[model samples]
Target chain A: MSEQYVEEGDRRREIIEAALRVFSERGFGGATIKEIAREAGIRSPALIYWYFKDKRALFQEVLGAKVPVVRAVADLARVMDLPPEEALTKLGRAYFAFERMDARVLRLVIGEAIRRPEVAEAFVRAGPGRVLEFLKRYLERQIELGRLRPHDVRSGARMFVGMLIPQLAGKLFFPAMVEDGLTDEEHLRNAVETFLRGLAPES
Target chain B: MSEQYVEEGDRRREIIEAALRVFSERGFGGATIKEIAREAGIRSPALIYWYFKDKRALFQEVLGAKVPVVRAVADLARVMDLPPEEALTKLGRAYFAFERMDARVLRLVIGEAIRRPEVAEAFVRAGPGRVLEFLKRYLERQIELGRLRPHDVRSGARMFVGMLIPQLAGKLFFPAMVEDGLTDEEHLRNAVETFLRGLAPES
Candidate 1:
């Protein structure tokens, strides 16, 4: 890439980081471009519009960028050929790790989504929606390979994703209830095991 | 019960309903007793204290009362003797029904739980904590009856609850992602079937 192009990309990344901080502190409705510009240390607040169209656009970019799992979901081809156990285990670990790392952003997205229909749509489109779609395709491939029993791959996708939701919810929204003797790894292993056994093909 | 005592109970219920509305609009930190009193049609804001100790108490009550599944979890005795398929199906239906009926309050508790640690603790203690504990006991009893395979009942309980989380989350946080061919009944059946098959006893 040319020097000027690289510099513009770096500047965009910086602005997104600043916007995430601002959005985390104040929700989507409360965050303003001026504050984001100040947070990014940009002298001209109007410069934000040079990169993004509006606050909604910036918010959408932030939602898509902050979640590391979105990138993982996009790169499913790397693990697509592995057995379901290994592939799912890797996915589960990455899923929980993202929850731990970007919990503040996750909370912000969830809280805003509840109040704003537009934000909710954007969040689902950017995050869980993509993850579920990836899983559905992965399950279909596994079934084709005779690794999984024939069933509704879509429901199977949701069920696998659902098996991981409680741990995330407990860790984020209810810390008191999480110390129920099992570590995250143990819990995840159980989830994957049950899912595989439940979908095992006939002998 | 005496007539006057019954009246006091009814008045307390009225106050809780009013508080739920206010809390749904504003959150835990944002809600105030005065506004709640106005919403409740109570002449004196101080009268709220007579039914509950303070705003925190009222908020807790609102969280507890708004979730119909909490009541269902407590009434598990009514379904304990049935097979796992029947009992778990009943539990899962009630769980989704509560999410539908009280999505607003669920959002309120979740949003506030992110902002306030106290609210988070109270929410888990009153809601998911009780539900998980009830499920754990029920699973343990099932194992004793030779119906389910002997395994870690605690993890089993969490796995069952986890299986239902995605649907609740999709309905509340992201409405667009839920209409994936299967109905709620179909999804819940998939979950229960997977869980029971995974935990089925050795022949």
Candidate 2:
């Protein structure tokens, strides 16, 4: 891209980042364009309209960026020919790492997704649903290979995702819980072990 | 208590009901005393202060009242002597019932709890921590009885609770997922069974 194009792209990214912070702090409806512009170090709220159509458009851009992080992990699982247990372990580690790195953005996505039906639908369709589909197919293959038990694919997918949410959310919303020594890497590993054990087939 | 006391108590309950609806709709920071007073069919916001001191106090009262719903379910596990699986099934049913009955309050509590650490702390202390404690003890007992594998209670408890959250959240944020002809009872039973299977000992 040209220098001017690159600069415009940088500005758009900056605005989205600032919007994520403001939206995560004050929520979607509560956040103002002026505050977002101020956070981005811009004088005019109209600049946001130049790059994005409106506040809703800007919100969608921020949300849209979050999908690929999870999607990339799911995509990794597809190309790997690892054992079921190993695949799950790798996926879990990736998920945990993602949460640790981009916790604020994750919270912003989850918070808005829960409160707004449109956001939830968009996220589920674009992100979670795709991940679940991949997991379901993988598990089905494992079941066919006699590596796992026959179970409802959807419920099993849900169970797998559910295993990670508490710790992920704890680390996000209750940092004190982690600071108080309740949610360290050891605890997370142990929880993962228990969850994996639960998924193991009859000996 | 006299008839006058009973009438006053009823009025207090009415006010709380209105406050919950208003708070859930507009959120803690967004909601106003005037709106709550109006919802309660009272002429002035002064009655809200007279009953509960301030908005924070009224919010606390609402939180306090709902804490027992989870606690009572946990207590049920202790008082009833049943097989581990059976007890868990009952617990799952009770949990699902509570979520279904008061989905709005649950959402409000979760959303506000995210914004206000104090609200989250109060909820964790009263409801979530108690449930985790009960589950830990119960699972430990099962381990001692040679019913479950030797496992850390905390990890086991986290997995169990983690399993329920998505379903609870899905019921609220994605009602259309359930509107496709599955009754709430069926969904709850499915989740409980999947979780129980996950927790079962290796055959």
Candidate 3:
């Protein structure tokens, strides 16, 4: 392979990564191609133009690139016979870490969903919507196995997500508002335990 | 009293209410004084300018007007002799209702806080900041009374608030994304129950 080809490939990936952050931080209307180029540290937008036709195309590319994070959360659902609490704890940690890894994306999709109609549906399908579905499936399995409490799967999944939101979304996106200094691991443990306790069948 | 005086007073209140919705719908940067005027049904920006110096003043006023919602949460914490779980349940419902009453304000503060540093601190003090502090104090009292599980006041409070965020913040702001058909009352009951169950002391 030619050295130039490798460099070009690296640059494309870098641009996409930068665009993802930029678009997430500033929604489509707020973010410009030039700013994306600037975020990517590319001096010439003509170079970005060479890769993407316009800001919409770049945004679509960025959203498409995020498919893997959703897949990673879905992957967390696939596991062997661990206890229900431990299984949920592990999955909770993975979900929190996945969100913290790219905090801007959640906030971006959430904030701009109103302005950009398509982004909301696209994001939920690629992000929380899938995770909620996976979580319900996991919870149903636990109930069938009698290893966990039976409850409203839909609302229960939302409650678990609710516990995750404070540190994962709140602290990550708005650090000033959240004063808890606990690392992501600590917060996740606390959140997951609380959620499991809530879900535990009356002993 | 003069009719003009009554009309002027109503007009000022109208502008503030309109500005509140507009700011919450559009962040600080996105909302313009003209748009606010339009939102209030005022034909002239000059009419708005007569009431306030600028958009910042209008926003500050709006924030000031939101003190009641925060107080409602604080009041929930003050009831005498309720068990810890019931106290929190009542508070959770109050908090949820408060957020729902004006969903746009919550979204507006959360979104613009990233860009506007001052708004985050001020709004938090007036909104979630006060609620969290009040909640922690209430929980500490409950733990001392041996009615609730021993836990980090901060983390416990975060967990409680976490349970509220999904519906309060998500549904109103991004209606397209959140498809849960549950009414506000149903969602609130589920959240409050899960939160209390999470905090239940060891049997």
Candidate 4:
């Protein structure tokens, strides 16, 4: 009986992995539960239903498990000891790459947001909300340590992250907007330098 | 007759205005040529075809004629005589309002961008592209006059605008993301404050 329970747990995890692959390929609207089940090699529709009440619930689970807002928090913590300029540059690059890699999932949330407000609100809370809060905490720490200039920590955090997104989103949505010579590294580096200069403590 | 030519011009202008209203309400995918004709008070579909090849061309024309990147350029000129703090504050608020009011038109352009690259490029050029270039010129002028600190004018323009977008877009897509007591005025005011302080010239 215990062995059967373990097998069921493995089956559930496999279904989630397969669902993510299907969703990424076909998008949430185009993907179906039976296709997800077939992708997972689970012949029984009942088994998939037993695991997730519906496709929406399964999609939400996949977003939470696969998308990595938490990875940003973890990555920032690793670089906390560096000076503000270096730490923020590293964090900004990580944030940029994170959003770039996860653009499809973000687009899914955005499309759903157009149809219903609840899904958008949930995504903000689960995704950008977490990253914003984490950056605020880091800024507050820097201010407390006198390593960074003091300002409205919340506004500062928002501005810092906001500086990184326009070019990032532009590149994703309008690939042609990126000039011939500019690169992601150069863009993030310039934004970080300008931001840090702007944030410099009053002389 | 000359009267017939004059009437044709008047009808074309009227059709463009009505199409703008219809497109804003229904988006590109949802707006139909028949409905546009109805909105424009024209019974003949051939009239719209005379002025536009299809809905896409009509949509592009409306975007170009109605959405005003030049408005931002013109607004900045009106505010140039003011002190840095006041000018930036007013300019930020105006930009904030511009994007807020034109959100629907911008969304239509973004939706089309997914299927074709040309539309996105045009938008970037007509919309944010023009605004960013205008800003870069203003910042360069300030730097030369020593009114603002010298920085990479491109980066400066980007950071300044980046500081303004989160709240504008949040109010559209995720109303709940906005915090209590952060009114539009307050949001713009706070962002302007943070941005200017970051750009303050060393005394």
Candidate 5:
């Protein structure tokens, strides 16, 4: 019975992965269950229903799956031993790396989130609000340690995230913006360095 | 003949404004010429053709109209008398204020730019490339004047503009993100100050 359950779980994941690609290419309104099923190599759309209750349910599942990445970054802030600057740099690198790997996912999320309040609310709950709270606490600790300037930690965190996104999103939606021969890895590392320099404490 | 030409110009402007609203609300593929005509107070769809060759032509005009704002900001860097920091601050404030006043127009430009290379190319030519070039020169001057840290000026400019966009775009697409009770002017001023602080020379 356990083996059967594991196999079913894998099948569900496969379906969700196919759905994400279709949904990203053609938005929620533009995509169809038939197309998603075809992409999944399933003969009947009914199989998707067996895995997910409906199209909305499947989309919510795909969105919820992104929570782990945001959570991982937030959890990194609590390690307590690393220097504040080092911790921030590590977090920034990890965040940018994730963005590079999943640029399409982020674009689809942002695009759909604009049209769907429910998606935006889910994203805020899972990602931005939680990440903001984590960063705020981290900055407060650094401020207490006299390691950083006094400012609104929330605003600072928001600015930090904001700085990374335009270039990251630009590469995803406008690959032409990136000059030839530069890999996404190179661009992201460069972006993280620039961001950290701006955020670094004055000597 | 001149009276007839003036009337024709008025009708063209009406069509463009209507296209802006429709495109902003419904997106490029979703918006129809018929709805645009109705919104423009035209009795027949054929009247749209009298002004614009077609729907695509009208869309192109709307995108092109944004060029003036970009040109004005670029001209700021050419004003040799203003100090670098002061000029950058003013340019940032001007860009943000224009976005606030014309959020719908900006959204239409950005949204369509994502889907159309021509729109994106026009934007790069008119805005980002110009802004970055202007900023690169400004930062180079600041470094030479010993006002900023020695760094790649292009990197500095990209960071500055990247940081500003999220909140500017958020103000349009996510008003809830803004603090309650802050007037638009106050919010913009505060944003400018925060950005300026981020750009301060390292001690």
Candidate 6:
């Protein structure tokens, strides 16, 4: 890439990083672009507009950068060839690991999402919505390959995701109650196995 | 009950109702007893002290009263004799129905729980923690009765709950994405079946 293009990319990354911090501290409705520009050390607040359309677009960009699920779904193509059990376990393990790492930011986004419908819409579109869409397509592909049973891939995708989220959420939000239960490995194993059994092709 | 006893009970309920309103608007940290008393139409803020020990205790009571899962688990004894599928279906159905009705308040508590650790603990203890504990006990009972396979009942309960929550959360937080997919009945059916199939006894 040209030097000018690379510099623009770097500036965009810096702006998004600053936006994440400001958004986490103040939430979607409460955060201001001028403050984000200040945090980013940009000389002019209006310069941010050169990169993003508006505050909402900047917020969306922040969520896209922060939520690992976005990257996971993007990378789903690499594991598309694996059988359902192996692929899902890989996906689930990676999802939980990244989620643990991103727990603080994720919690802040979720908190905001609950209070603000627009934030909730942005969050779902950038994170779970994309993941669910990718998962449903994967389920359909697997069923076509005769490795899985035909069913409502939307709900099937939901069921698999459903199996994973509550555990992560419980650990993040209620560490006291999580108290020495199944190890993460065991939990992932059980979750994957249970999901596979439920979706196993009929004889 | 005597007139004085009846009056005390009514006053306590009124205070809890008022506390819910204030907490919903201002969150756990922002809400104050004085505001709650005013909302409750009590001349003395100290009267809230007689009803609840403190703000945290009052927050706990609001969660307990608003979250249907709390009452569902409390009444688990009535369905304990039923088979696993039958019992779980009933419990899950009740949970979703109540959750839909209480979505606004539950969302408020969840939003606060992320920002405040104490609220997280109280929320879990008053809602999901008790529900998980009761479900774990119920799973153990079913396994002993040979209606379900024996395994880690803790994880078993988590898996079952894990299946239900994401669906509810998705619907609550992202109506745009849930549009015209599986109906609530279909989603619940798939979740319960998947969980049951995973835990079925070996032939």
Candidate 6 stretches greater than 4 Å from native: A1-9, A32-38, A44-61, A99-101, B1-9, B33-38, B41-58, B99-101
- Provide the global lDDT of candidate 1 against the true structure: 0.81
Per-residue lDDT tens digits of candidate 6, residues A84-190?
Answer: 88888877876676554367667778888876788888777777787788889899999999888788888888888877766777677777567756677788888
Computed on alpha carbons, the lDDT of every model, listed in order, comes to 0.81, 0.65, 0.68, 0.69, 0.61, 0.79
Candidate 4: residue pairs that collide = A198-B198
Q: Tens digits of per-residue lDDT for model 3 on B1-203?
A: 53355588898888988888787777766789999989988778988999898776776667656644465554653553577657666666665555443655666666666445566665565566666777777778788887778987777877777776666654655453357665556766776677677877787
Per-residue C-alpha lDDT of model 6 across residues B132-196, encoded as one tens digit per residue: 88899999998999888888887788888877766778677767568646777788888888788
Indicate the fraction of true inter-chain contacts that candidate 1 also forms: 0.62
Task: Give the number of the best model, judged by DockQ.
Answer: 1
* Clash pairs, model 1 backbone: none
Candidate with the larger DockQ of 2 and 5? 2
- TM-score, every prediction: 0.87, 0.72, 0.72, 0.78, 0.68, 0.88
Superposed on the true chain A, the predicted chain A of model 3 yields a TM-score of 0.65
Residue-wise C-alpha lDDT for candidate 2, range A75-168, written one tens digit per residue: 6546345676677766666556654325555555556667788766654654555556667687777777777767665666666766666666
What are the DockQ scores of the candidates, in order? 0.66, 0.32, 0.44, 0.48, 0.28, 0.65
Residue pairs with clashing backbones, model 5: none
lDDT of 3 by residue, A1-203 (tens): 54245487788888999888787677656787888889888877888998888766676566555644354454553553567667667666666555442556655566666445566565555566766777777777777877668777767777777777666654655564477576667767777777777777767
Best by TM-score: 6
Candidate 1: docking tier: medium
Screening candidate 3 with a backbone cut-off below 3 angstroms (N, C-alpha, C), the clashing residue pairs are none
The B-chain TM-score of model 6 reads 0.87
Question: Which structure among the candidates has the greatest lDDT?
Answer: 1
Which runs of model 3 end up more than 4 angstroms from their true locations? A1-71, A98-101, B1-71, B74-77, B98-101
At residue A119, candidate 3 shows an lDDT of 62
lDDT of 4 by residue, B1-203 (tens): 34245587788888888888887787666678899999987778777898899877776667556655445455666755667677667666666664543666666556565444676676566566666776778787777778777777767777777776666667766665566335667766667766666666767
